[model samples]
Target: MQNDYMIVKEGGHSIALENGVFYNPKMKGLRDISVAFLKAAGAGGTTLLDSTSATGIRGIRYSDSGVAGLTFLDISEKASENTKRNVKRNNLEGISRVFNKSIQEFAHTREKFDIIDLDPFGSPMPYMNDIMKLSKGGTIMMVTATDTAVLCGAHPKACIKSYDSRPLHNELCKEVGIRILMGYAIRIAAKFNFGVDVLMVLSDMHYMRIFYRIRAGAENAVASMKEGGFGTYCNSCGSFGYSKGIAPVFQQACSNCGKRLEAFGPLYLGRLYDKRITGKILENLEDGNARKIIEVINDELDIPFFYNIPKITKLRRVGSASPAGIMSALGNAGHRCSPTQFSHSSIKTAAGIKAVEKALRSAKDFRLRAR
Candidate 1:
């Protein structure tokens, strides 16, 4: 009866979402990425703990994909039973175990996991410390945050309260959300005397997923905190800059227009992606959409914020310009530019707002001359 209600196939595993168990068909791409990342990370024969497994689809897929040991933990009884059923359905019992216990409790147990994945319904902040306590040096911790509204600065109070970091909602909201999550992770891990080595940062649909490897040390944590930076955004000029440190020395005026600027940070100013790991993940991708997603992230410039071409154009009262044309102009001007996978109308470039506006104006003049 449970199997007859609702069933979905993902990563070659059949998962049943009957009896009111939670399962989102939309997360298949996420599962695909997880599988690829795990494979790329050489997760074979490694122990994995899905601390907040919903229907156990992710952990089941991992176990089936050759993770040597798999454990599924969910506070909900229905989810636990569903996990057990799904594990049995996939014949993954040999390499998998289901626990109807809280992740908090599991964190205090003697069990150790090489990979600890925390994918919750919203912010993962509440469980960050517990997960860190359970993780050993060299452990890989995967975290997902779905509170985009908060992380993107739509709810600034909540963002600051939950993440202990400021967020910006603009052309760079996605990147800001990604970094806020990372910066929060770095700060929390540091509390446990752990340093985080980011392996990947992914933005998809309505959530941000981050992968980090934890290293044990007080000095490393201190160094990481010092390396993080805050974003200074000027709403009036569409210009921004990054300053490294936990507390930003706010700039009162926009460097380009002399208009006042707003600061958003103590967020992650470090690189969002590790090129080598991303390349390996790309090689391991079997799904077309997943491959496309990684390709976009792979091509994104390792800069602070991306410019929304249309937004900037509207602000400057300029005619519409091609993303490719703008990028080419900026490239010709000796500034690195690339179209971001985050938004079709956005471009990641080292060029300042004034420089970009100049590029757009130049493009417009060239067009008028051609006509």
Candidate 2:
């Protein structure tokens, strides 16, 4: 109706997806989360750069949420035109500027932003260096990568080439993928002498998103690098462990089943979520789906990797066990545990595999007795 393409509504805003422009309807939840995060971080009166603004929905919503100044950038001219239209339709033209140029080009300008959102079509690896050039102290960077296959270890060689880290091709792949991303970004930022404070991370659907704040200083960069390490997995027993440092002496065999352990990393081994920032986002959040995801993320244990209950149950041949029941059993044993947002059938807990297996057996037995 507005242009050559159809008009669609998302996050309560109508956007025109012009022909040849890229816009994904499935990313609405992520856009909603972005708006909430901006509001929570007091992004009002600050400038924002939507580096891959397709239809400009994200930047427009951010403007509505009180972001004072906005710059929408896209490589396609059609995308830039569509964003311009959406800005006007939303009455945000007064505060928004649209540019048809690559982010690398824009980075050459003296303009810096308080927030930089990079939601590219695939890996954000190419733009990480330029992105750091547009950041100042305390700048918030929101990055999204949809190359799930590469990062999740379906293409191990590709991950190594792109992220400079190895990935696990198993039940723990999603979490490992996220850590690899964090590690990659931290390393890139460190090159610019900017350290990252991870605010939150999400591995939803087919993509992974991370929100982090950039802090300036060589000491801070070194501190962030200290969080980089390697992870060892026991494919035989579904057990995994991580050690902080570039080269950690890993146990040769699985501690649970005595099978050989495989190493995967040069990945991040730090807290994935900063509870304070997460709490702020929750306080400002209103979307149901975003709220549910954030609540789970808020409660997720700060452990490195999670266990897939289905995989564990099948491996141990202990019959089926419920995730809630397993959590209850672990809690009863004084071990802290919580469900991870990465997978419904998985959980993050400090309890070792033996303890987890014992809890699973007990829970299974209890279920059989009740039945």
Candidate 3:
């Protein structure tokens, strides 16, 4: 049992991990980002709830960041005991509480949390309604979905069943996954006449995390619903376009190429991350990978899809061109271009596929001439 006391360092806090309780070292960047987000957003008057706390690392970290208070809730007695130990170990008895019961038990209770963090082992979809009920106006809810396949259209049926939205799998699959998750959250919150303002979203290494601020009222709910839309992608030409609203009509042929287009969505097509909050998060990040992720996110266009330069070059049978040179060429041609966080070699630009192909060919021709 002593071996279960393995100490783990995460963000600005340290905790002892239990044998059966989950504590992934790989998720350290996520924890650090959460901490930075809280600092930037100002966790005011918020009683934080780590709804799926296994080892209590997240709750303890939030408490250490001076959140008003936090409740560490877990269904496992082993995890509950470990949470108590970690709370005591960190000397945070005054502002921390441990509960060993299914989070659903709290649904009936009048008690509500200003911030409820759901980092479950799998899909958070099943618990969405109950958590929506537990949220009050102005509540901040954070959710993590590890079912990338379901959210990314690898399993279209499951994605539709779970999130009630169609997903796209391609170069922009990660962004589609994020949007699918966001669409689900918005719709779930709308059931309770609560609207969500997405604060931060991340798709890092096999999981997608989202933070939202809930606003109460039927009007806000309708406004949030309006953000839902669908994407039409042309497999033949790599051309894609999005139509706003739930009922979207897809053209029979691709606008750029005369090939049939495949449709994906009924998902959120709005902005993924708040620019101001992301800028602040970038300032607090110490890890290179996390900083780079945020930096790319900050630079990415609010558009739906990004084109992988390598894939584009391969499609054209031209020599590979640097992403930087392609972006520079596109920018010079009076088009907005930026690298996407989803793929390092990809660019999200207003330039059409034809324009991109031209840019790539021009860059290659210039390089050959110089040599």
TM-score of each: 0.94, 0.95, 0.94
Candidate 2 lDDT over 1-371, as tens digits, reads 54478889887788888888887777788888888888877797999999999889888888756778999999988889889999998888888899999999988995889999999989999999998999998999999999999999999999999999999999888889999999999999999898899988998888899999999998899899999999999877789888897566778888777889999988999989888877888887775887899999888898788889999877765577789999999999998999998889988888788788778877777332210
* Best candidate according to TM-score: 2
* Shift in Å, residue 79, candidate 2: 0.6
- Residue 75 accuracy (lDDT) in model 3: 90
| Local distance difference test, each candidate | 0.83, 0.88, 0.83
Give the Cα-based TM-score of candidate 3 against the true structure.
Answer: 0.94
* 103-124 per-residue lDDT for model 1 (tens digits): 8888888576899999998889
Clashes of each: 0, 0, 0
Candidate order by lDDT, decreasing, is 2, 1, 3
Q: Which stretches of candidate 2 lie over 4 Å from their true place?
A: 1-3, 366-371
Prediction 1 TM-score vs. true: 0.94
Best by lDDT: 2
Instruction: After superposing candidate 3 on the true structure, give the runs of residues whose Cα lies further than 4 Å from its correct spot.
Output: 366-371
Which stretches of candidate 1 lie above 4 Å from their native place?
Answer: 2-4, 366-371
1 against 2, candidate with superior TM-score: 2
Please give the lDDT score at residue 130 for candidate 3. Answer: 82
